[model samples]
Target: MKALPITVIRSIELLGLVLLITVLYVGSSIIMPVLLSFFISIMLLPVYRFFRKRKIPEIMSIILPILLLALFLAVLVWFFSSQISVLISEFDQIKKNVGMHLEKLSKWIESSFNYSATEQTKFINEQSNNILNSLGNILGGAMGSFSNFIIFFGLLPIYIFLMLFYKNLFLKFIFTWFRKEDHEKVKEGLKESEEIIKSYLLGLLIQITYMTILLGGLLLILGIKHALLIGVIFAILNLIPYIGALFGNIIGVLLTLSSSQELSSVFTVLIVIAIVQFLDNNILMPRIVGSKVKINAFAAIIGVVIGGSVAGISGMFLALPMIAVFKIIFDRTETLKHWGVLLADERPKDGENMI
Candidate 1:
């Protein structure tokens, strides 16, 4: 075989990378529904196992969880719908307060920076339109998909049921398809991936609960109305990381301003969110997630951003778990463990050995 020129080699490498990314994008779109069903299955598996280990009938285990999950989802939908209705009913006041807040903010910026009021207003107007238009775009496609939305919704539960039933067989198939020498490694990888994903999901739920309690307590002390509503919304939103908390706080402050028009209230909400973020970043994540997922901070943030860019909210939520799964599988392979290690943040020091 003839040796390729350096330029040709570089071109080939770039082409390969581009092709790989394109395939990944296409594959994600094609397999996203199946993956989501599997994600739900993974979450329910532990509960199923907990019951099965006690000699509970497998059929009973499946029926119980599915029924409970359906009830929980119904309650969640009702709660969000009621809260959203309240907000929509108060939209007039909200619009007024928002406009007033913008005026105050523009003036404050001008006074602080010694800029012309006219220039500040112009800048604010330009920025606000861009923000609003972009928001409209984000929401534009959402409401128009009624038929498709119903179809997807109708399929989800059925998919979840089938996924739970077939999960073990799927795992066995994966192991059997691999070489005999790699069977143990593949099995271990699958187990680790399952544990990591389950832990991450549970950690997320725990964090949301913590944030709700913390934020709710603070808001109550600060005499904010609808404290529970705002706190819960922010807590759930905070799950998406950097942008999520920011979005949550922005909405919280807006609600506070509309309800009271008190700058101090807004400032307090901002501080509460900041403190919660600090604790979450430094404390909650490590203790809850346990680092076995093998995603580094930089990659985690970048993955979230890319996910948000591609699939919006769902993407942001799935990005880290997907990356963690990749890391887990990669780590199980001798040739790929180095790459997986690079993806991991925590490493043992001194004479410690990692399993």
Candidate 2:
């Protein structure tokens, strides 16, 4: 066969990329749940195997691991609900604090920028109306999201159960997709991808635990109100990589400021968050998550952005693992190894130019 022109080949690749993205976006409602369940199922494989090894029935083996997962999620829900309830009980105080801050801010603006208080009030009222309209839209979207969440979780256990029960059949299907000579490479990819998903997911769980403890504990000791709520919010948001931490900081500060009139408390929250995040990014995460996936910062950020654009928060969370799996497959294929290199963190050798 004649070799295709380079431009034609490039165009074909680009077209495939576009089609794949479209499918992911269009089918995200179905696909996102399946993907999430697949990763969770992989992480629970050992637990399932342990039960089976003990002569447990197949149904019991699957149910037991999923029950454990449900228990963990239940605890998280209870914790957040309790914290948020307490926050709600203090609503009047929070509102008063917010009003005081607004008055201070308006005065500062008037003194510094010569903006009249009446003008500022008018501007704020105008913006508040706009904000209220946006909030209504957000609430509507959130209702749809909540319904999707129910459906996602409703199907999660069933998907995990079926995936576990049919593991061998799935493996057989995968093996049949490749040539006989490529079976070893296929097996290697499956094993490596499983290990990566398990480690990555478990590492994130540990990260969330320690982050909440460390940040929440410090804030509580420093007498910050709603410390646990702030901790929980930041810990969950921090899962989205670079952009998440920034939002976490903003939220942490806002929570702190709303609950207290003292400026020092805001500074305290910021300093503590900065210190904890520094430790997490530098010391804890590196050791906990390790460098198993080896995705570059550029690739990770882009993957997160694209994933968010395509499938919202769930997509962003799944992006790293998906990219890792892709890189593994790409590296194993003769024609795609260069694409794998592009996703990796490997730097050029000394005296070598990237080009």
lDDT top scorer = 2
Clashing pairs in 1: none
Query: Candidate 2 overall Cα lDDT vs. reference?
Result: 0.93
Question: Which portions of model 2 show Cα errors greater than 4 Å?
Answer: 132-139, 350-355
lDDT of 1 by residue, 102-124 (tens): 78887888789988889876887
* Shift in Å, residue 271, candidate 2: 0.8
TM-score of each predicted structure versus truth? 0.81, 0.96
Residue-level lDDT of model 2, residues 1-355, one tens digit each, is: 9999978977887898799999999999999999999999999999998999999999999999999999999999999899888889989999999999989999999999999999998998999999998998999999998998899889999999899989899999999999999999899999999999999999998989999999999999999999988998999999997889999999998888889999999999999999999999899989987888799999999999999999999999999999999999888988677789899899889998754
Clashes of each: 0, 0
Q: Which pairs, if any, clash in model 2?
A: none
Model 1 quality (TM-score)? 0.81
The TM-score obtained by model 2 is 0.96
